[model samples]
Target chain A: MPSLKDVKTKIGGVKKTSQITKAMNMVAAAKLRGAQSKMEAFRPYAEQFHAAMASLSAGTGGARFPLMEVREVKKVELVVVTSDRGLCGSFNANILKVANRAVAELEAAGKKVSLVCVGKKARNFFRKSGKMRKDYIDIMGTFQMFNARAIAQDAAANFLSGEADEVRLIYGRFHSVALQRPEQTTILPIKPIEGEAGGAAAPASQAVYIYEPSQEEIMEVLLPMFLNVMVYHSMLEVSASEHAARMTAMDNATRACKDIINNLTLIYNKTRQAGITSELMDIVGGAEALKG
Target chain B: MAALIQLEIVTPKGAVLSEQVEMVTAPGYAGVFGVLANHAPLLSTIKIGNLVYKKDGRDDIVMVSGGFCEVSNNKVTFLVESAERGSDIDVDRALRAKERAEKRLAEAMAQKEKIDRVRAEAALQRALARLKAAGKM
Candidate 1:
């Protein structure tokens, strides 16, 4: 058993720790709200963009740009998004796990793999691995539109330049406050998304239309723009998921801290009671001995 | 009566407007054009100019930047780079921008370094459009 002083000091330390964790949890909660709202605002644009991509390219089988070409898989580029900060539960680790497995899988299939990391965590994770094509770090907390554009340009250039035969983006998908799942999406080839009603009907409607600018010109700008949107969308997801994961982790930490503080208080009280009883017994026994 | 067209104006930020309207007139890539209900499946690039729409017997104005417009099945969607409705535009800000743009244009002639002519021109156009939308032009 620790001395009363020691136990008292420990309780003070734990209370301070709990206060810090509680504050962190509150901060994370506030940030999560902002991030979640930002993500919510971006969802319609993504869905509309995908819908428009499907409908616009419906006229043709698919655009004939190099972006739409499916070549033999010789090299694969993975655009990996992770959180810039740690203490976000397993969010960044999950991303790293999925990304590492993907790289290994690609390599096992007799393909060369390169990485384009989007966050500090990803950059740090893959630092020892000599497979990074680009690492845009510290862009997760304070995100910018041009960051997405810059990333999209790099990915498109790699695909067009034949450095990468296929390009895939791996990131945490923000489902809810309690859940963020790591997901992978293939970005290159700009294929028409299936199960969408408008995409399939595009081919039939291509014949009887007046395209203001020619069909090919629109495809030239739209495909790359679509790629940029995808990158932007992924970054937005990372932001929201990071905040949510941090909030949950901090909340758990706070709860654990509370538990520890409770247990410590209980122990301190018992030790105090034991010390008081021992002192009273010693005084009573001494008085009785004096009387005898 | 023709079915109303569901017009949506979306920028990278988010959807600016989504409504069922009777008519829409936008500055297209080639020129300004108007669309009613049952327009054919058409796609056109939007130019930086004023977008005019009529709904509930009132005409409203929006300043739109470069983007694309698609019309299909009574739904007209304008995927724009940026947009601001007339009511949302700050008249003072627009006027200030106009003054700044004009000042820069004048300063460009006397400066030794080459001025970004395109940027200044775009700024001027955007300010003009905003002022027009706010009914201060």
Candidate 2:
């Protein structure tokens, strides 16, 4: 059994650790608030872009753009976005798990798969497994639209040059502070919804738009922009989710540390009381023996 | 009497301005273009420069980077890469940025790097736009 002094020292160390975790939790909470606001600020732009695309696709004949071309799925490139840093609970692991599942499914179907990891964590995770073809790091914390544009351009160039058969983006979608779900979305070869092509009759009335440039020209410009914006938005979501997850994890760790400290304090008190009682009993017995 | 036009200026960050205005003058790709109420439907790429909007007999200036402008149905929308209101722009910072871009441009030319030169030129334009909007140029 450990001595009381050792237990007391351990309790002190645990108390210090709990203090540190509590500080970290507060910092994470502050950062999470900032990230969440940023994510919210980006939502309007994404929604507007999507609405514009939906309206445009509804107005024009479907599959008129090269990007809308559905090709055979022989090779798939997955762009997995995760945080560069860790300590954010399972934020990175969940994304990797989803990507692994995707890889397995693709491989089973005799399709080759390549990875375009966007963060250090994802890059490092897949690098050891020799699964990543290319990786970008150190951009998640300070993400910018230019970064997204460059990445989207590279992916588009690869797809256009027939280097990859298809492109899909996998990332964690932030639903709330308590919930984030892994999502996989197709990035290339825009798919039109059903009953909307060739002026097909649908439940809702389709509005006609006067395309300034040809539909093909608009698509040529808009498709890449759409992809970049979508990717940027996803990055923002992941950032917010990471902060949220970190805040929650740190809070839980801090609480656990506190509980441990409390238990240790109780044990230390009991042991100290037992030692004092035993010393008193020895003194009384010595006095009684003297009297005898 | 001129009709009221709904003008919205949006950046990647968020919507900067959305209000009814009397007129708007924006720096177009070709040149500076002014739009009033009942203007024809037009779509054009915008260059890095000042955007002046007249609302309620007051003129509000905003510095904008390259993006696009769409005018349709008497509503004008400027989707800019980045924008800052005239009141928000810092004149000293703009001057410093301008000087930095100029120095970078010279260095790029000396090094014979076309990409660096292009980026420096863009930075210079953006800085100049901010200064002009702030009435420092």
What lDDT does each candidate get? 0.85, 0.82
> Residue B84 deviation, candidate 1, in Å?
1.8
Provide the lDDT at A286 for model 1. 100
Poorly placed runs, candidate 2 (over 4 Å) = A193-215, B27-33, B39-47, B90-128, B131-137
Cα lDDT of model 2 by residue, B49-116, tens digit: 99999988899999998766777778888776688999999999999999999999999999999879
Candidate closest to the true structure, highest TM-score:
2
lDDT value for candidate 2? 0.82
What lDDT tens digits, residue by residue, belong to model 2 across residues A1-292? 4579988899889888888877887887888788877777777767666655665565566456666667898989999999988888888899999999999999999998988999988898889767687898899877588888878878888887777879999998888988888899998866763332644542133333334455455556667778788789889888888888888888888888889888888888888889999999999999999999
Give every collision pair in model 2.
none
lDDT per residue, candidate 1, A45-89, as tens digits? 777777766656666554477788989989999999998889889
Q: Which ranges of candidate 1 are over 4 A from the true structure?
A: A108-110, A141-144, A195-208, B1-5, B20-22, B54-59, B90-137
Per-prediction TM-score: 0.84, 0.86
